[model samples]
Target chain A: MTVTMEDVAREAGVSRALVSIVFRDVEGASTATRERVREVADRLGYRPDQRARQLGRRRTRLVGVTYAVHLPFHGELVEALYAAAAPTGWDVMLSPVTARRDETTAVESLLDHRCEAVVLLGPSLPSRALDLLFARVPTVVVARSVPRRTVQVVRTDDAAGARAATEHLRSLGHRRIALVDGGRAPGAAERRRGYRAAMRAGGLDDVALVPGGPTEHDGEAAGEALLATSPRPTAVLAFNDDCAMGLLNTVRGAGVRVPSDLSVVGYDDTAVAGLRAVSLTTVGQDPDALAHLAVTRAIALAEGDAASAEQVVPPHLVVRSTTAPPP
Target chain B: MTVTMEDVAREAGVSRALVSIVFRDVEGASTATRERVREVADRLGYRPDQRARQLGRRRTRLVGVTYAVHLPFHGELVEALYAAAAPTGWDVMLSPVTARRDETTAVESLLDHRCEAVVLLGPSLPSRALDLLFARVPTVVVARSVPRRTVQVVRTDDAAGARAATEHLRSLGHRRIALVDGGRAPGAAERRRGYRAAMRAGGLDDVALVPGGPTEHDGEAAGEALLATSPRPTAVLAFNDDCAMGLLNTVRGAGVRVPSDLSVVGYDDTAVAGLRAVSLTTVGQDPDALAHLAVTRAIALAEGDAASAEQVVPPHLVVRSTTAPPP
Candidate 1:
């Protein structure tokens, strides 16, 4: 049997109530009695149970976060969220969604912990579920669009970022540009729409697009397809930095020079994009501003402030060696 | 003031005990009364307090996990650990170590949730602190080595993996090889020792060593230094896949051909290594086996099993398209 507070009390020759007070580290027990009770508890190999003590508290002061493990950008945002929560006296609890674990399971774990508010990072959940969640608790959706006014939103302007990327390549005299789309991802549609609109505005009759996803392998596949085209595009815009890097490797392997032969642009300037060896030109989102807005909104809603806010941060183009005038 | 269980019970004309039974989903409350209480609670915006409910349960069946957000391999291992723990009916709580947050703050959050056992993935804590943690609760350390026998350990044989990588390059007719080290990471020392031993075994009088760390930028720096040497090495063994990829990009940019001019080898066959565009030849550690051993040992210890286990899985070389005969 496990040792309990009563067992420590009996060994230390003190009342059970005194042992409880000492173990909880709260006032009402004398210093000598506290020391004696702790010694006896230590001798009995008894650790204080945090769950029991939490029952006596009125507030948990916890904010839950659900993030995908594979997204490096999401990891950065989580780090920033910690800093954002420090000044507000709130602790952040993370529930990670991996390949094996679904978003539902992650969100359920957060609810089980009784977090006052929850922030879902790049959530793929359906709109109805998000609306229900917003009604149930103070919910903040990041990197996804939600129509409900009850939920708080924090996201990058993907369409504007994609338009900027296309216009930059067009200004460099690249008429044949292709967009390697991220199929079914949260921000894919907006990016695709932006690319199409920019191409139309540039008076390009023929628009090129290839199927891709959020991985390097997908980028490689798209690159191979681009190489096999009748007239290879002068420039390519990938869904994200990972895809862009993959395309770069594929193109370089085939003896095709970047920017000189085919200028490349990517989204989400991750750590890999900034490396001296890579130096990928990409669209960069301000994760600090996104995290700050999400945290502030969640805190306000959790603290019974009824106003829900929607925040949209613009993405900027980070030009490097990857993009140049096509030969 | 926030709505409480007592307020909900009073408004619904039901006892607080009955309302709790309904909230807990226990069979004590009648169906009609349960629906009425839930309806009244919803109208009053009263959510069930999980902390109060958790106090009545004897076991939490929660295993806390601590991992670094920057390490992609750790992310894969975490996914595998989740699969391994599914059969045991235990939930996982994640605490991430990031640039802004320290391990202490992360661990404290897990302790606050009252996790039954903790599985620290590549912990950077000192041995004395690990021993103290083991005494306080059932603990398992993955990737990092601890001197305390009370704590369970699961790690790859890093020295053997490094030796295999070196030998693979040696077998490809490359004599002059340089080592790009990880620099103070968990398995850096062992890998460095293994590379040195393999070089000496191959009877190479002059061993080339360069200063490189865990990231791609470090690899780029090492590559720059290697290029400046009078006689550049015929082969290079990077500390990890990230470093190798960086070196590959650097060498390519300098008009140096891989495998034909300088054969390259990397450690830790990460997802990026397996991509067709990269196709990095590296050492592969079985993450599934490592995660399984750690989770099983953690569960056994948490259930009061006294036998502490130390598990070391061997690493094997994955011969991809990277290594070939040197010019």
Candidate 2:
């Protein structure tokens, strides 16, 4: 009555070898063949044995990554992760979930793939979801703050980065400054906190905080709103470069001169920040270091290292032509 | 004796069930167990019979994609491809290969994965590569021209787009113009041919062609070269938006004003072209439409549809604030 590879293969109309290949996740079998083999095995009430397999091998050498944010910078992070992991003979597989898919579903999907360890980038998953994932697999969270003792966390200092931006503007003698904030974004709350703290620290507590989203469109809307204020702020610190670029465009379209009439600063020095046309002043996070640390920590946890609660990375500023003294 | 799942399970010291899960590529097994199973199987010289397994199942709904270009726009294209294909019950698996990997090797890698069909993005592979691939599996190419009679091709109309850009500037009373050409890029030859033909057709063969590359750095270099020219051309047409953004930055740094002193036009109306700061006058190609077409054609080929040699999509131009009459 026990299910056999032959039984499943026969039901799926494939040879036992083909079924084995599909199960092994080896290259050479077409995607169609793999899908068919998995379906047939599932139908035949088949299950794979794990404890024996582990005893036979030293390591799985597979890392799973789940990313909720698809910003262009994430692509760079993914590339960096590949570079960091590849030399160590580890392969990274990505499973991306949109807003519609909850964190549990995403984590479960990675678990389904038997990922040795999982990394969640800017995850919006609840704390319970993190606890569940920690119980099932070695889990690492990037840019998410979780109080659970079981999970490992890696994050850039968003609050500090925000404060740096605000201070940079304040040092330029801009009294009436504004922050185009990333409203309800993953790291928005921490960034807002940083901005508030910095404003107070710099004795510019009256600085405006404008609500915005993560996209360039939101930046434009925020820029338009800021322009409507009775006394326009001389300097603006945007949530990120995308928003800054949007704000730049909207302000320029309204015939405002940059660095003379208005000085703009952005965050996350993406490739666009360095573009000749944009040349945005912004905050920089070492994406390469962040990726390397996440993967190395994930591997350590997979190898049975005790989990740590947090890994915090410092932030720095990259000044270009976007900010100037108020005229 | 032919290698068996029992042998793999036994070697791995995992239960047959664990081996099955690992081999099936299912979710439940831990990463450690899956790696072990695969390692043991590899050591035992196991090769799964993919064709046999596929015959058992009606079809495997997986598509394989190999991206040769790493530009951000290419990432967007890949994303679009995934979005277009996912709705049809198909999932995409990526095969990471370097530019050094020849077309034959690339195709072989896909074959090893048993991809139902393959999509090559901006492949550097020659026509013979397409011939070799068509022999084993159905294939579609994006942004590459292949002379093979059997392989399907999808590309944007680079020539027409270039013409529109040239005409736009000419109509705005710009007599002295220059082109920052993308030398030896995949579509560069077509774009260059388009630019030359358009200039000749408009009775303006005196325009300069400055050699360039695909990167923003290249654009900066081109901008420097153009600036050094005597009575510098009133307008410059860059290879793409990235290059244009770079040139714009470089020229602006040199104290030249866009539109008033020097008009700049770019190709590939990617998301960058629309940013408020970089309101580039650019040639537009519908990436969504192109992605939809590429996926639809790829699926058709996988379903055994008769293969055609090539498919071309038209390109248009979007006039933003970057272009104006010469001062």
Candidate No. with top lDDT: 1
lDDT of each residue in B92-159, candidate 1, tens digit only: 77888887878877776777677788999988887778788887778888986665456888999988
TM-score of chain A of 1: 0.83
Q: Report fnat, model 1.
A: 0.72
Residue A26 error, candidate 2, Å: 18
Error of 2 at A196 (Å): 2.2
lDDT of 1 by residue, A1-327 (tens): 557777998999989889878865689988888888988888897765555654555566788999988789898999889889998878788888998899988887777667889999999988788888877778998987665446788989888999999999999889999999998887888899889999999997568889998889889998898899878899999999989988888988898988789899999999999988888999999999999999998888888997655788999999988889889
List, residue by residue over B149-209, the lDDT tens digit for candidate 2: 5678888888888888998998998878898999877678788878888788878867799
Write down the RMSD of all candidates, one decimal each. 5.5, 11.1
Give chain A TM for each model in order: 0.83, 0.79
For model 2 the TM-score comes to 0.75
Model 1 residue B231 lDDT score:
81
Interface C-alpha root-mean-square deviation of candidate 1: 3.0
Error of 2 at A106 (Å): 6.5
